[model samples]
Target: MLEALAQNLVYGILIGALYGLAAVGLSLVFGVTKFLNVSHGELLMLGGYASFWLFALWKVDPFISLPAAIIFLLVAGVVFYKLLFGRMVKLAEGDKIQNTLLVGFGLSLILQNLALQFWTADTRSITTAYSGAVFSFAGVRFPLVRVASLVIAFVLIVALQLFLRRTYTGKALRATVENWEAATLMGIDIQRVYLLSFVMGAALAGVAGALVAVGYSIEPAMGMSWTLKSLVVMVLGGLGSITGTFVGGIILGVTESATGFFLSLTYREVVGLVLFLLVLVFRPQGLFGVKEG
Candidate 1:
């Protein structure tokens, strides 16, 4: 029983890394631009498909094809922002949030239908020669793919942190997030920052999707579920703290894993919603979020 529990815990942490990666992108966009891009999940789905096709056609490894996925999503993000979100940049905060929500939802629906038409509603996953390989330690088994995924996720998250902290554009982004009007006064281009944040968010989502394609199954309808999970983690970790958001993802992953182990598999999905509700009612600022004045 202990071994089983340990195995579940390990699995939780592995999956949690991905949850964190997915939420980080969403958090960045919301924190920087205040535009809630609800279509983020669809972007992830597209990433997964991009990887799937690359592997299916050219026999490319999913891991090696990550750059392709990132590039694809980056271009898609640029088009999306310029066509839809760019116009809403100057709206009042309240209007920006409301309009983005509606537009994002509509975009998600359109993307979903397009995917369905192209992919035919079939579930897809990437299975490499080593996909089923695993290693055991002290009676617990660890899948090689999942472990690699965790490492990759951690590396990407750290790289993002470094980018934000060490690069000039990153500093400008932070400044804008802190105070867009003041950033503008300081000669920072607010529009450029917004565009960069949105594009980066989409790229991160693409990475998460590629990882998911290798570690799990993806379908056209999977977008909303992943989007909600990202939202939950974002709230749990709070805004403006990427590390906190990543930890929040780990917490949610472990919670779901434990619920599945002790209770029923059916309850795993419900547990996240329950936790989200509790957090909202008791501490809307999130675990790491600073309360607004």
Candidate 2:
């Protein structure tokens, strides 16, 4: 039992790290842009497809394709900003809460169906040199690819955190999140900031998708699950706090891992949903969110 538990914990943390990275991107988009990105999952899916195609066709390593997909999706995100998110933001004007939701949701559906049309409903994954290798540590075994994915995600998280904390753009983005009005008053190029931030967040989601494809499965419908799970982490960790998302991701991952071990695997999702609702009722501010009112 102890061995099984240890194995689960090790794997769970790795899985949670990747999940948290995806969730943090979502949080940043929602926190600063004040919009729900239903299409965010599609952004990830596209990246996954991009990476898989590169590997399956050109024999490119998944890791190498990961950044390639990011660069591609980053451009896609910028286009999405110019065509869709920007329009929604403008439509929101000052009272954007409801409008952003409706707009984003509609956009999500459109993007989802469009992907289905192009890619079909089949599931996909990429096999690599270390695809099935397992690592042993103190009588516990873990998947090597998963470990690598987690390490990559961790590095990306640290780099992003530092970027957000130390750079001029990072400070400017923080200003927008802390107070959009004041940010504009400071002559912070609101339009440019909005465009760049939205695209950057979308690009982050795309990168996550690429990393995930290396370890898991992807289908047209995968986006919805990713969106929901990331939302669970976002709500659990507190919306908009990058640090909180990391903590919340691990908690949710470990909870699911333990539940799967002690109970039916079919009920793992139910356990997660219940946890999400419990947090909603008990900790509306999330685990780390500051109370607004």
Candidate 3:
């Protein structure tokens, strides 16, 4: 049982890093813009699919394709901003949420089905030389690719933390997160912040997609699962807190591992929902989120 627990924990943490990557971006978009991007997962799927096609046809490695993926998502984000988000802001935040949710969810369905139509819903994975190597420690075996992806996720979280703490535009995003009304009053272009933040968030999702393509099955409808998981992370971590997202993700990871070990694999996913409720019941503000910072 102990050995099985260890293995589950290992899988959970590595998987949680990817979940953190998903949630952090989703949380940021919600924090500043106050819109829950329901279709955020589809972008992740798009990222994976983007790399898959490029790797298949152009012989490009996804690690190398990361930049192109980021750029593509960034452009896609900006286009969405210009075509959709910018217009929605004229409506109230509540209206924006309703409109964006409808539009984004619609887009997600379209993307998922379209992917099935084009790709045939087959599970696809990248077969790089490093794909099959596993590192064993004590009694468990850890795949190198999963480890690499976890490292990338952690690095991204830290780098984004540093960016938010040190840079000008990052500061603007923080300011916007803190108090949108005051930031608008203090000469910060909330609109620009919204555009940039949304774009950056989308870019983060793109990177996650690339990483996932390295290790997991790629499909059109996979985004819904991820999007739901990210929502749990965001709520548990506190919607506007980057650090909170990390804490929430790690907690969910450990909880999932524990549950999956002792209980049935059938209940593995239920752990996230349970944790979400447990956190909200105890600390509605989230693990690391500040109520009125």
Name the candidate that leads on TM-score. Answer: 1
Write candidate 3's Cα lDDT for 1-293 as tens digits: 67777888888888888888989988888887877788789989888888888999998987888899889999988987788677776678778889988878887888889889999889888988888999899888899988988888888899999999999889999889878889988899999999998988899888888889987767887999889889999988887678779767777777787787888779989989988888889988888777873
Expressed as tens digits, the lDDT of each residue in 65-174 for candidate 2 is 77798898889988877876787666544557676666667767887788789878888899988899997889998788888888888788888889999999998998
Candidate 1: segments with Cα more than 4 A from true spot: none
For candidate 1, give the lDDT of residue 98.
99
- Cand. 1 Cα-lDDT: 0.95
lDDT minimum window of 10 residues, candidate 3: 84-93
Which regions of candidate 3 are displaced past 4 Å? none
**Candidate ranking (TM-score, best to worst):** 1, 3, 2
In model 2, the Cα lDDT at residue 246 comes to 79
TM-score, candidate number 1: 0.98
Highest-lDDT candidate: 1
The whole-model C-alpha lDDT of candidate 2 against the native structure comes to: 0.83
Error of 1 at 76 (Å): 0.3
Give all TM-scores, in the order shown: 0.98, 0.94, 0.95
